[model samples]
Target: MPANLTPQYHKAEEVYKQAKTSEEKIAALEEMLRAMPKHKGTDHLQADLKRRIAKLREEESRPKSKKAAFDPFRVEKGGAGQVLLLGAPNAGKSAIVARLTSAPTQPTPFPFATQGPIPGMMAHEDVQVQLVDLPPITPDYFPSGMLGLVKSADGALLVADLSSDLVLDDLETILAKVSEGRVRLFDPAVQTAGAPADSDEVLLVRIPALLLANKGDADGAQDRLELLRELYQGRFDPLVISAETQEGLDRLPGAVFGMLKRIRIYSKEPGKPVDRSSPFVLKEGDTVLDLAARIHRDFPEHLKQARVWGSARFEGQAVQRDYVLRDRDVVELQVDL
Candidate 1:
């Protein structure tokens, strides 16, 4: 099938040509992917774009010289999903991560206290999600590799200081900077549906983001949050929290999990009990065949039938290979060895 590429994709291609940094190139490629039509005709093109994005990300995450400073931006993804904490200087991004995860953090009063990305795992009920606290994104000081890190994240928490009068402006600056790099923040209203299958116009990389209004206990903080909602209600929703006092922090893990849009599936042996402690994490809409393939590369082909414990009509109910699995579903694949 011929890829009937659109004008938007070609325009992004031109931007890719003019891009000076890897971050800008990645943004352009992501835009191209978003603008390209989602169909069999463009499968090869889409695959190529994705490959290029991955290659660029890998290269950017590596260190350039042995004598150069340690690449603090390089973070290996772990757990159910990877989320990045993004905000202006002294916006409490590191404080939030330190409070939520076991990662060592120095929460100083000075701006730019965090010069590199520090990763920690946030526990949510039975599963854990990886959270990386990154350097502040200021007008004059943003790491050239920041966009690559942002593109690798499954979601983002846009932290802002509710006590500061410049909070709104700070948020706007972060948004504008990221947009200029081609990584558009996700807005549910504007991106309610995916691009039309027949249409060649691609959409930009719209990452689901939650605005964190930190220092909520400070004076006039509530008013700042109100103003923020008033000005950017349609663009993003703000979650008020105080990392210092740990107020409203209890709900943050669940919120991050919800934004990840992932499902957990537990595996069980044919005659053994299910291992509920560790789960195989997969995106939503995964099937039994997909689970089988995850278990073993040959399981998908040698599979006969499977028994599902959760989201089934009955416990241990026999299901076909194509049975769609749900979150926390216990699966037992009876494959022909």
Candidate 2:
């Protein structure tokens, strides 16, 4: 069973990483375990994967039915991308959501605030991304059904209260609850780990998070902020801001948008040319065939070749659908006419 073990494991892990929800991750892990070979070397690995899977399942079922049912949640469908915000109590998650998007969010100062997910639409340079604000979670808090929501996010912003000396404690507590290992930041150069085995869920969380230290305007907050960043050892790109006065708020949108690895490309159709003003935003790794598939699955199947007439070159250069497309590049599909 050593045949193709490496590649098979890799692909499964990739899928698990891309999975947006805990349910999806769990399903992927089960399959990985099934595909993996049973041997002495893999025994420990298998056991660890199974234990993690069980923990996810157990945490998913921790809350009561009434409490779970009462969780206010919304999943926004239309957007270039989506980001979920994570933080502890009074961390200004709701305020940031309200400041960035056109969502009517309630900003309160109580513990266990925002008992559910609130969806908001954020627009940037004609592109729109959805943001979700989830309920505050402490070190010991693992509310039922919240894991799935966090897993679904394209990216996550870890918010902290810089004005308070306990900001570092907050980060450690929150990270302990939701994260595992180094989260991938969608870097094209760095390859992912070995493929996943059956029953092992890959959490492809985009990391190098945008760390926000709220209450920047408060006295002595700046010094505390520096100390926190140094303590993290550049693990996070820290931004000091006051959600109330909107200080440093302008940069938050950019940070969120930048995390999205997607780029826009226009398609020059055979008969009807694609619109450049409103192009589709796709992840960086997507190839011309990927775009074709997005436009129509059959496009890739029947796609004989394609032509490019943008950034990569001048005029139109005929090419294959597998050609990797770049940001702002214009492509023309040569299909059966």
* TM-score, every prediction: 0.80, 0.74
For lDDT, the strongest prediction is: 1
lDDT, model 1: 0.82
Minimum summed lDDT over a 10-residue window in model 1 is located at: 193-202
Full-model lDDT, candidate 2: 0.69
Give candidate 2's error at residue 290 in angstroms: 0.4
| Whole-model Cα lDDT of every candidate shown, in order | 0.82, 0.69
Model 2: per-residue lDDT, tens digit, 1-337? 2334555566666777887766667756755665666554564465567666767766665665664554444364458777778888888999989988878788987777587788898877767878888888787775645665665456777788876778788888778776543233321222323333332334333333467788888888888888876876535657778899999888776666666677888877776866777887887756776687668746766778788877556668876554668877888887663
lDDT of 1 by residue, 1-337 (tens): 7788988788888878877878668867977887787665775576578668878978976767888866556688899988999999899999999999999888999988888889999999889999999889988877757876776678899998998999988988899888776566764432442443322223245577888889999999989989988987667778889999999999999888877778999999989989988899886766787688667868877888899998999999999775779999999988898
- Model 2 per-residue lDDT at 332: 81
RMSD of 2: 8.4
